[model samples]
Target: MEFKLEEFTLGPSIDTLKKCKKADLVVIAESFDVDVPVNINKQGLMELLIDKLTEKGLFKEPAPAVEAELGALAGTPAPLQALPTQTGMSAEELKLTLRIREVEVRNRELEVEAMHLRLKAIEMERGAAVAASPSATQSPSQSPHDSFDVSRHIALVPPFRESEVDSYFNAFERIAATLKWPKNVWSLLLQCKLVGKAQEVCTSLSIEDSLKYDVIKATVLRAYQLVPEAYRQKFRKCEKTATQTYGEFAREKGALFDKWCQACKVETFDGLRELLLMEEFKNQLPDKIVIYLNEQKVVTIADAAVLADEFTLTHVSVFSSPVRREPVSTDRRVRSPNGARRNVTASASARETRECFYCHEQGHLIGACPTLKRKGQIKQTKTPAPINLIQIQPLSDKSTKVVESKKAQIDSVFRPFISDGSCSIVGNEKSVPITILRDTGAMQSLIRGSVLPFSAQSYCGTDVLVWGVKMSVIRAPLHLVQIRSQFVSGEFQIAVRPELP
Candidate 1:
């Protein structure tokens, strides 16, 4: 395959330069009015002519495609053809011919080497040019490919809500514009980025179906429509009840209107004001106030507001300024450090005198008395020293019976159980075995309700030393209980049973 430089650089702008023959290319270059070489071979002649034309700026360098083809040709050598019959050739002439052929091969090799270096230079220049272009300064989102992460960018934006469809869609449109996404893909991207109820409505679709932005908008609108109109109906029905003040009624109606507007995407300021005034004049306020307002011929919201304020001021006393009283301290009496009670009737001087413990002076006491100091009579009184008592005959050698009680090292381990005061209290009604769980920390003992109506003679108060603390207990007498085939006295504590209603 052969390609000419003029094909891409200066030849007619058309696809597939192979359609034009070499002779036609030559003719085209000659027609450019440059001097043409008469004796050069076809390949070399064409290269030289192109170089001259490029130098004169009549033709540009070849395109990258042309340069690639040139490089491939440089790497591959032309096939060798058989020489004509050499029957009459001398030996010396044949030797010279062989030398010339060898030199031509070396020249072609050198040309190929030079072509490679030229191609490398051209590639570096192209790269530098692209790097310096303004388009290189664009952000990833503005790039002409799928380079930016769409999901990550959308995550920063707020999710859409059924009530806030208009605002959400408007913001979405701005985002899509900034991203420069095509219209066909807008709906698909929105569906992918949907959240909340909007996301639930349009679950993810396949890429083929996701491209329909119209379908996505329709689906979202339909979902929004399905949102209940109960708020709107409530707003319409809202009125000032007999007990509700004008301010309270207005606040309730305003709140309901705001909710309805948000759900319905009703954002016009004039429309909202008109709706509020119409509802107020038509149904909310009292008939007398309405008739008075009509008599005054009030029309605008400003006039209606003035009338409402006037009516409230005249009829509602709750909004009037409250009568304030003088703040008085409720404290009855104050005590001085010297145990003197100073009531509210006491004068400041009397109170200060009461605060003085010794001389009854208002400003200074007997110890801190300036008058006594000036008189040189404020002497420090010495306190009596405490006498030390010696130990008398080692506390008289009090005799104590030291009964040695053996404390066997019982290595018994048991898991602690929490008792909910539901254990059965079986007294010695018969010689049956009964289990007793003793909690030394229990505040009171529990008794079964069936063994109620305790006898007054059986109850006795006793202070038992438990865990080094004297704990009060109520001991009651029980019938005889046998333990290990021996009769032992059994006793239970008296417990109160709650009376049933």
Candidate 2:
């Protein structure tokens, strides 16, 4: 179905205008007698004709592509594709298909770019969080060259002692290098703070502004110089037991020897192994075991330590078996064959006749006697004397007068601060008397729940000090109430530890 160039004088219908291609639009423009650019592109020509046809009220805008697809699917030919001939229709269809595919590819590219950006944002957030964490920040905060404070750093470093002087000097030398202090002042500073006998050699110099670091160091070291015999004597004297582990004993002996070497300026490893081995064998094991090792000639402390541990475990097992053994009663009420009970009291009496040599008492041997321990404890001076609340124990009738006089003397000379008080506790039903001690050195307050008439399980080996003597106490929870007076009170919580003494 073809049409002539001069088919209609007025512009074509809206449907015909919508269906016309750029070539058809250019032909229509020429037919309408309107001036068109000689070099105008197809798209420009199409737009110009659409404007001219719309100005003349002969055409309307085409429907969207989606509506066009729906219209085509419903068996109606779209307005934009209503041309009779199909010569350039395939090219237009190909261009529209390529444009839609290009749009889909562009959307996919945008989505991938957005995903990458989101992942980067998440990584950046995690990095920031890790940097903000305490563990991650700790190392950076500890950069010595940046935040070093000499007095503060040295304050944490303990005081120099003879035993640890070598390590101390080595560490301080590094710190001095970092601080950029003069090398000449190093030994002089150390000499001034000398811990042991090293100071004795540098005493009373009387020289001002002329003492050299090397000279001071040499003099102190000379004083520390000792012979191999001295080292042997000191090392051999050291001992360890099953109660003390090999590590602890080694540390103690090492410190002692180090101190000795520092004082003598004498570092000798001679006979050291023999001394340590012998000491370990003698002290860690029993006498019989020590003799056996001496016969075998054990040379290493490690071997001796192992043998000693085995011996200790064996002895413990042997001793513990007796407790598990059933006690056999020596009762003399056994029935004889003639139906008469024969008394075995004489045999029991003869067995009980053994006496303790230490206490000279009957009915017990020296090994099983309890009196020897009491005697030794009485002689020991390490035990702290109990502080007496009252000086004298008077008769009942005269006790009041003596107490009054003692109280007067106490009030006048030695006034004691009483810690016990009665206060109402929060979350409790009644006011109770509590012993409150003011320990200025303590980090937290404690209370005894046993004083509250409640069940508080004991935590054994929980040590505390009472009147300067170390004692064990039990832990519990305490609801504290501070009473300023009879009318005013304040409630608070505190950790409770029972039986302060």
Candidate 3:
């Protein structure tokens, strides 16, 4: 790419040597039109030419027929909206478009580099010319108007970008990658960069009329969000720290908000006046009075005189307000106006069965349940869940042992891991044994990742909508023979693998 320096020292505005020699004599009063050729210093000449030909405003090519462009070039059906809205785009087309976009990005980058080099060359040329000029002052010059002194590195800036958001992101990514950020955090940072670039380009291309700083703000938020998640230790470390700071700020804001009531200069402030008449408001503040409406407790400012259309002191103290209860007519301190004590009033009517600690039901403990008692059912002793297990919830550190033994009684069932070297699994239709791995790292389950066939019903459901297109599910039952079991030695259950399950 040829990088031209418009308005350069040698640009079209370059004054002939005659003009400078004539004009350099302290602007002598000239007769009529100047017969002498005017000479421009390299700096002034470059500036004038650049100002004329350089980008005044971004120009975008006329919007293409988006449908034809996408469908023909990208090989994806274009949605009604230019932005991607549906999954009509096949995976192949998506990959191709991504590649094309990546290439386009590189090309634009070269263009930017070329422009930068042009600017640098123009600057260097002016510097050389100024040094060579004999009339130039030998004394050192200082820019009295410039307040800011620049460093070798440009990164000292805070709200750095006056244009081009990608500058910030590239710098951010460069820093983060150099530090070797954790995988999750790196992913988030990269995504933020991508979105920032998208927004930046959208504005440059005039696709969006307004490109707010929301992109940068969101990137900062996502960067912070990924921190605690990636570095778990900091989650605990900063929890209390942030909480304390927040509390202090909230308290200050709360105090300031209250001052607004007293400063009310309005002549007739009925709400604040009424609120001040209330006993609670008189003692505390205008916002402590509590009332209930539609099962929700509402607090308002008690200083009725300061009540206004915008804010309510009514809800100020709602959090600490007591629930209003109906007055008790009967003396029921000993009983519930019947025979039982106030605490035990609901019981002693019917033979209420005690709940089982094991089964969590009144009828039976897990030990007596058919699931565990069945002859063929494999029973498992109570065990604390393993940290690296299928269950998604965070595990409790505390442990409690069950006093009463509970047994599960169930029809014979089998779960087996099939690992000969590679993987081959077999199962019956109903209750098949399978190692269900839970990956919190993953956003969704890969049902197809499992070798087992999905149930026909599952395939037909809305959940199986493939790429937003409805697809049918296939299901069937099969005996799992190759499965291995940790629960039972040399034992396996006939697992089921539906065609679509």
Each candidate: what lDDT? 0.49, 0.51, 0.35
What's the residue-level lDDT of 350 in candidate 1?
32
Summing lDDT over every window of 10 consecutive residues in candidate 1, give the lowest-scoring window.
387-396
**Highest TM-score among the candidates is held by which one?**
1
Tens digits of per-residue lDDT, candidate 2, 1-56, equal 35433332222454565566666776577555567998988777777776886785
For model 1 the local lDDT of residue 322 reads 32
* TM-score, prediction 1: 0.24
- Top model by lDDT, which number? 2
Question: By descending TM-score, how would the candidates be arranged?
Answer: 1, 2, 3
lDDT of 3 by residue, 1-501 (tens): 222222111111223222443233212112111233367564554344334333421121212343335334333443343443445777787667656654543554464466567657878999999888843654455332133322322233223343434245557656646755433343323333344434344334331222333444444434444221222223222332211455775665554334334223213566455433442332332222222220132224422324421134455332222324432222213222223343212221111344555546664434345544664354442222112122111112243122011111111231131111112332343323333433334322222224544443223222211111133332323222343334333322222322222
User: Against the hidden reference, what TM-scores do the models get?
Assistant: 0.24, 0.22, 0.17
368-441: candidate 1 lDDT, tens digit per residue:
56666666653553222211111111111133222111111111221132111212223324332222233455
Q: Select the stronger candidate by TM-score from 1 and 3.
A: 1
